[model samples]
Target: MTDALNDDRKGWMSLLAKAPPARLAALMPDLPDHALLRAPEVGAVMVRGRTGATGAPFNLGEMTVTRCSVRLAEGAVGHAWVQGRDKAHALRAAVVDALMQTPESAGLHACVLAPLAAEAELARAVRAGKAAATKVDFFTMVRGEDA
Candidate 1:
């Protein structure tokens, strides 16, 4: 796949994985039947983190994850890895992932992906706002021997 296409797919996949299960289900449309290449399976993955966003990575801890793979009737294959052991969520996410590559993607983007992105952005903004409210400005006063 081209870089642009791959990046676009990556964006939606991340969004779907992080989306709330019940909310994603509610916004989901009538998905076409698909063949499950891999049934939903739960597993644990080691979480990694970097200090100061540039330091060497360190193992944070283990996290529960669920993954599923599906092939759409139209030939597109999709896979999903989501946090937690929500089998249904993984299945639905995989289905969406497959469908997003087809011609019907425009409608799905408008109806499902758009709202999810909006909600995610709004929630992020709210969290940022809360954090900003408590921010401490450490501006050094002009008390040095410069005056």
Candidate 2:
């Protein structure tokens, strides 16, 4: 892939990274259908920062990130995690893993990550536009009065 497209894909991945497992589950039902020879188990939790517009840094509360690994019936191993209590994320991550081990990475990326990314982008754009429209400019003008 070209650098621009790669960057776009990264953006898509980032959206998927932040996505809640439940949301993803609604979008991709097949994620949870795979028979898990292995199942997801919590591995780690870490505190992360919340960034503001213009990349300003802000400290947000710690988030719990669970990681798990699973093996499908076809002998493909996958790993994934969800923020908070999201089992769906772990399941989907495993499915993606199994797909990646096969020749289905492109399909998974397109069907799952791409649409999620597009939706996220649309939501962000809408929010930005709304905020911009509501912006209020304040100014003070001085006039020559009795002196």
Candidate 3:
């Protein structure tokens, strides 16, 4: 796949992962039946962290996650991994991923991804606002002699 396509898929997958399950479910219309290549299963993955964005990574902890993979009748395959053990969420995400690769992806992007992106952006703005409200800037006033 082209880098741009991969990036686009990554963006949507991240959005799907972070989206609220109920909200995502509400946005989904009737889905076509597909075979589950990998049924939704709960597992723990070791979380890792870095002191800074470029720092050496270390194990942060383990987090419970659920993953699912599905293949559509038209041969599109999708996969999803979501935090927590929501099987339905995983299934839905996987299906969406697969569908997004098809020619009819435009509708999926409109009906699903667009709203999720909006919601995610709104949440980010709210969070940034809250953080900014508490931000403290430190400055040292120069004495007359120093100035």
Considering every candidate listed, which one attains the maximal lDDT? 1
C-alpha lDDT of residue 78 in model 1: 91
lDDT of 1 by residue, 1-147 (tens): 999999999999999999999999999956688999999999999999998779999999999999999999889999999999999999999999999999989988998899999999999999999999999989877867877
Give TM per candidate.
0.88, 0.64, 0.88
**lDDT (C-alpha, whole model) for all candidates:** 0.94, 0.66, 0.93
> Which of the two, 1 or 3, has more lDDT?
1
Pairs in clash, predicted candidate 1: none
- Give the 10-residue window scoring lowest on summed lDDT in candidate 1: 138-147
TM-score of predicted structure 1:
0.88
lDDT of 3 by residue, 1-147 (tens): 999999999999988988899999999956788999999999999999997867999999999999999999999999999999899999999999999999879998998999999998999999999999999998889878987
- Tens digits of per-residue lDDT, candidate 2, 1-147, equal 499856754554445557766777776776534566546555445555646655766655566665666776666666565565566676676676566556667887788877777787788999999999999998857656832
In Å, residue 33's CA in model 1 sits off its true spot by: 0.7
Candidate 2 TM-score to native: 0.64
List candidate 1 segments past 4 Å from native.
51-53, 137-147
The reply for model 2, stretches above 4 Å from the true place, is: 1-13, 31-38, 42-44, 48-61, 73-76, 143-147
